[model samples]
Target: MSYDPSGNAFDFHGSSYVALTPNLRKLGGEVEWDNATKSATVTLNGKTATVRMAEESVTVDGVQQPLSGPSLVKDDVLYVPASFFRDVFGQSI
Candidate 1:
């Protein structure tokens, strides 16, 4: 894994993914972890999204969408597909 000011980035299946927290923070979003469920809840602009590890789908604002790949948790850090920045959060990556 490699970290930039943006966040930790790594290659998975030839695509790049990034650590979720820093980018979410940068977007002014709040992230809450649910260790019991192995998931994270992200809220931004009154919208909430739930992402879980080893899952190919996520729920955004109570709606489910196909995730590009499974989310991953490593050493307490959450890594999400980079497309998540643009596709789900409406942030330019």
Candidate 2:
């Protein structure tokens, strides 16, 4: 099946881990996943946020931390909490 951004877009059917992709580049969002740390870094407008896999939470600029829900991974891509873009980056999906 083709990946649909509108349906099951938020990877809610598996582990809490989610992957981000370049398709979201239009939102001016950048995601960096560190294999060693198993942490995902999200950057927007020069501001950066780090989310630790073990914690299943995100910290923005060392403050304003938020807990994330379930995440999905398919085809080596990570699908994270959809609200991440809006709540963290201030971007309207």
Candidate 1 residue lDDT tens string, 40-90? 999887788999987888899889998788897666688888998788878
Predicted structure 2: lDDT: 0.62
After TM-score superposition, what is the CA distance of residue 91 in candidate 2 from its true location, in Å? 0.6
| Residue pairs with backbone overlap in model 2 | 19-78, 19-79
Compared with the true structure, model 2 gives a TM-score of 0.66
Backbone clash pairs for candidate 1 read none
**1-93, model 2: which lDDT tens digit per residue?**
236554345434442322455635766677778989767787887778886654546788888566566334565565667676666777755
My TM-score estimates for the predictions, one after another, are: 0.87, 0.66
Q: Which stretches of candidate 1 lie over 4 Å from their true place?
A: 1-7
Top model by lDDT, which number?
Answer: 1
Worst 10 residues of 2 by lDDT: 10-19
